[model samples]
Target: MTTEANSKSEEGHDPFFDHVPERRGTHSLKWDKYQDPYVLPFWVADMDFRSPPEVIEAVKQAGAFGNFGYGKPSPKLVDTVIQRMQERYDWTIEPSWIVWLPGMVCAFNLALRTHGQPGDEVLSAVPVYPPFLTAPANFEQKLVKVPLILDGERWTLDFDALEEAVTARCKTLLFCHPHNPVGTVFTREELQRLADFCLRHDILVCSDEIHCEMILDEDSKHYPLASINPEIADRTITLMAPSKTFNLPGFGCSFAIISNSELRARYKKARAGIVPDPPAMGLTLAEVVYLHGEPWRKRLMNYLRSNRELAYERLNEMPGLQAFRNAATYLTWIDARKLEVENPCRFFEKHGVGLSDGSDFGTPGYLRLNLGCTRSLLEEGLDRMEAAVNSL
Candidate 1:
């Protein structure tokens, strides 16, 4: 890296993230999943860094009160969300439009339930987050997968394929913005084209925007798929949260933004009776992060951007591996088809590096590596991967 690039990379890296917490014995899903003590985990979306100090302090304050009870989102948190939309995206929304969910996966199932009948089809581009593939089946609806084509360096939607794939039973499109597995931030032109396509097909769009805040490319910006136009907004249900941005997934808090009252009503009805509200701590942390998490978020993004560059450069150099640059998120998607191995995930685990299997994301012969760890740890994992592939 050039000196200027190096300086830019270190712009806002917080010293706090340097101290990775010891999570092995804490019943962590990522760390404790493997019995081997030397295997480094890079499979899950969970980050190794602690939550923002402000969020931790807020948690402490809540602990002092010592009363854990069922709770609803407060007025302040709702208002903060409203303000965040307007300030960040210039998209204005009313408080009544927010429908809280315990997690984005629940929102996915609810989107299918509210918009489609059993046996209807849910349209989505693969490879995507695993839930998008299974949510349709959970609702007895069929999932129609459209492969995203590799256009140069980035993976993008195939409009022609999408048009050919849509049928009368296709009722909803489960879209992932700043998409998982393969990170690609759709351009405004692309989103506009998608909005037009959905409008033409009379398809409801359930956009998963969980990684909106982690844009790694300086030139890229996130536009809520619903924010494209008033018409699209009416047919769109956008899922967002502070969990991915603030490292608070264990709290289980997320929400859906629905501009159309009728659609919003259907969503709420689908989630009623069974879907539980977010815990009190989740709501409180959300409030604090939205109100005060910007500084920490900026620092964390800087650190992850550096890690992303390192991983991309290093992984692509491996003889049988290919890695693409991510426009957003702390995940790097790698293609390992050429490697002389049957299962890449298990193969790497044997080499002391655990990666998310691409088969789980509807694409075999590929792997998703989490880049959201301390710099030293990321370096160690990359070193292990490099040596493993070199040996092969």
Candidate 2:
């Protein structure tokens, strides 16, 4: 290892995340799920990298006190959340409008249950994160799936289909910002159109912006739909988390910024009996990350960009395989229909590689590869995957 790899400043972040922590025996869902040490698991969205040193130190400091009792979020944490939106996205909101949750997935589920009635319809684009498909059904609401059509080199929203699919019964849309699986960050114009569509139909928009900070493009940016306009803000319930950007998913701290008092009230009411506040440690870690994790997050963005480039290059080089570079997120979606494998997940697993089955994301014959790992680990997984494909 190089000196740069071993050295860590108290305030600076290392660019190369080549270190792989020993997670096999640590009860990690991502590492231990296969029950096979040989398998390189890339199925889950979580990364293998460590959280920011600042966060780790904060956690250690909190643990030293050794009193893990019930706690409330600090005013500083609330201010940090408010400051982040304004500094990063030029968006503004009050602390009163914010509702903290255990996780981003929980935020959307709670939103669905709060806003939708039984037999009502919820709209979402296909090939989305699994939660978008299951959350509506979990709350006795019907999900109306709209496909994101392929446009040349990238996947795009089919407004014609979206407009046609809207029905009177569809009162809510669980919108995935920068979309999962497909990984396309919707543009400002595109977001405006979505806002218009939802407003025209009087549908509540639950925009999930969990991956907003993991943009691979330096020029590209994540725009919260609610931040576009006041009316849109009133209709939108945006969910975001430091978990993805700072690698704190295990901490389970995420929050929803609902500018509209009515929607916030409904969400709070629905969550009253079920949803619990994030743990004290999560709150402390969130504050540390938000305040001191910027240097680490920037380095991570650079590292993730390289992984994206390598995956984009190698996957497209494979025979009968096609992949497009995404503007955001560390996930790359591969179109494996041309490969003609009956079950790509099983096929790759046989060769010691585990990828997310596209079927789980509403897109059959496709796979989502997580690029949030070391370059060498990613290369090894892809090499094994390619060797498997060649065997067929």
Candidate 3:
């Protein structure tokens, strides 16, 4: 791994994050989604910032090798993951517990396949990631959407709604930690309550924790759901990746941690010839970032904190708009139900700001904005959104 220089706070201010690379015409899904060149796309979760410089340099070194072949996670990478879990989350995980995959979407889909039978049910909170909404159907299972109740500024899980929705056929609970749009970093108490609920229902949990490292609030801490206790650990499958944290989603690498031998075997069986290993380059990048990307990651969190504050303050200022003050992730969830327009997303899109439609996340009359961009770009998007809302 390449060594990083000491990152000074004063020096870290502008040069690194302020520069926005031109991504258009490069087949970037975030940039190329809109045919209109003027629209600023913030629909996807990926950041506008380039990945850590150390990671980029590693990529260059790997490319220089000139041979791309079938690859698996190196022992170093697996050991790094094990150490990270133990050190960061205080969760001790064995090497045998790891199962590598090309992407998180595939991992969760495989979770549904392994744990749920056809005609079974999968439960998840509403306004979740779009994949959680669709993965159940892909496995011929019913998706039970439980609404998350708002407690002042934060969104919390509703056990009452969950209890009402649980049924005999409920085989799996699809969970998102540092949850996608709402960005609620689960507290220990919340995790305990959720774990108890799952234990009582015997529901296998597939916790998507891809955003585990992106906590912006100093008071908030991310705990792996399985790390709550051994009982819950036996019943939970925690999915994570460096892709989201390091802006390497295009590299396509992710993993699942299943402590239960039975579940691990089942997951492997489900992924058997159908799923491919993560790309060789992706594994290389993952190892490099995990080992040497901390300084860069720290600087990133600092930058995102300001962006989150600016976004939350701006969106809430707009009439008929309310932005959730999220504890983690670079996503701001907005309530646009009170807007006079027929469609909130199109309204902003027309004004040159493209946002993820809340309807797609199973909640209509709301919008999710990506605050993972430079201040200038984010300000431009917010300005468009404000003008659009004012016209109403």
Q: Candidate 2: deviation at residue 300, Å? A: 0.6
Where does the lowest 10-residue lDDT sum fall in candidate 3? Answer: 1-10
lDDT of 2 by residue, 177-233 (tens): 888888898889988888888889999999999999888887778888999999889
Candidate number with the higher TM-score (1 or 2) = 1
RMSD per candidate (Å) reads 3.4, 2.8, 1.9
Cα lDDT tens digits, model 1, 325-352, are: 9999999999999999999889899999
- Candidate 2 yields a Cα-based lDDT of 0.86
Cα TM-score of candidate 1: 0.96
Residue pairs clashing, model 2: none
Candidate 3 residue-wise lDDT, 289-319, digit = tens:
9998998888889888888888888888999
Model 2 Cα displacement at 152 (Å)? Answer: 2.0
TM-score of each: 0.96, 0.96, 0.97
Q: 2 or 3: which has the higher TM-score?
A: 3
For each candidate, what is the lDDT?
0.91, 0.86, 0.91
